[model samples]
Target: MKKIERGMAFASRHVDIFKCPVCGEGFEEVMNGSFSCSKGHQFDFSKKGTLYFLRHGVKSDYDDIKMWEARRFVLKAGLFQPIIDEILSLIPEKNYLRIVDVGCGEGSTLKYVEEQRTNREDAYVGFDISKKAINLATRDEGSAFFCIADLAQLPFASKSFDVILDMFSPSAYGEFDRILKSKGLLFKVIPNANYLIELRHMLYEENDPQYSYSNDKVLTLFKRHYPHAKIKKITYEFPLSKTFFESLVYMTPLHWGAAAEKIDAALAKGLNKITIDVLLLIVENN
Candidate 1:
């Protein structure tokens, strides 16, 4: 089947999870390659088989195709596999699951999760604000669905999801609380001080404020919101190829503000292995 047709079919099968962003009405049908709600708001499926839920254009540095491609390369190299495995281990075994990956850039992580659990029946939907990201995400034919959406105003219905994955992305707790089921789980990943330490050292001088990093504020805020949250620290290193190293430099935002000369210097120096230090916060909805 064509990409649009496959997307429409997926939407038709799982239309209950969707809500109109404009009027908060549930989608009633998928017709003429579009999803429409009873209130008359229609969202058309793109040629790539992805839906756009954003009413306006939102500019982001992550909208670059090259950056997303670089990310795909790095992720496919198993650099983040350990983190993904940890997340999978935490998810409760079930006959069926409804999962949504928020800020799902390029859909690599969601795709990996789906690929790991082929025996079970589950619904996987991923969304991001970047149209470019969603377009690229839909390129791969998989059971997972991709869409362009705003994090602040999610298009999914309330108490709809069994699990929510937020990987190195900004948190929309209000929207998260609304869409997640009563006994749902939210797995949020945040970087630690040593995450990409090699890259950080190469990108900035010792005296530069960017040379040092901290997640204390983020942890504090998360604890304030979910006082009973459980935290797990994951630390490891993955060997890097020359090509993979270059892709890593392009994939991360750490070098975005650095001087060109510094980035060049880092590339010239090269890296053998990179550290992956991160904290996973697990919260259960009451």
Candidate 2:
């Protein structure tokens, strides 16, 4: 039997529940039932019993190794320490034995937390679509599974994970919902509107078409799959340097711009500092 099929069969035994906020529709249990919309929008289940209803299929090859290395440096510099602290604080006391990091890039966050956490042993799986990312994560023997897979097609059983980490990555809500158990928690770390204000100021046309408003956008998207969603926002200032400037230049989404020439000119002024406001959402499976 295929791995996914086995998971679905097991999940069906538990009798799962689903709801779509966009349509105000609910299904008591879809353990063995088909998933569909009245407007003919239907999503089929994988062998693992998770449904994928991704309307858009956009995946791209990330930047080169130099870019990845820069991101690794910034994260390791502890500039985003506030994010780490908030995540540790919100973690509920539970006997959660399985955890997964969706779109886990290079596994730095998971590696750090695993060292402090004795709550669960070898329960961490850092999954990403990029084999380069997965290879980097697998080097950490502390982590359990490192796989190159799509979020919309998670290779796990329904209600299998105790916690799902969606940190600064594309979210697959249906897959997240399918993989989490009733008591499971999803820790989503989204960028607040002012996340990288200095970069925005430098890149955008007078701070218009900003990336600052992603918090509400993300919440709105996820509220479609789960109820009782709430956000916890944290703002912090990071001391910067020449290396920090390089890291920010390439690692951020702000790097893409039609006004690249202007942005480069602004950055040359040797302005060596910035702040980040992040939203750490702790949404429970309600």
Q: Top model by lDDT, which number?
A: 1
Please give, for residues 1-286, the per-residue lDDT of candidate 2 as tens digits: 5444533443344322323323424333333335443433344555333344333444665625555666777877886667876776677655545668878777777877676576555366666665555555545545344545566666565677778888888987887888787877899887877787877777667556663355676767766665677777788788888768878687765776537685677568645678788877787775
lDDT of 1 by residue, 129-158 (tens): 888888888877788888998899999999
Candidate 1: C-alpha lDDT:
0.92
Error of 2 at 264 (Å): 3.1
Looking at candidate 1, the ten consecutive residues that score lowest on lDDT are 132-141
Error of 1 at 245 (Å): 0.4
Candidate 2 Cα errors over 4 Å, as ranges: 1-59, 93-96, 118-120, 207-214
lDDT of each: 0.92, 0.64
Q: What CA RMSD would you report for each candidate?
A: 0.8, 8.4
Residue 232 in model 1: lDDT: 97
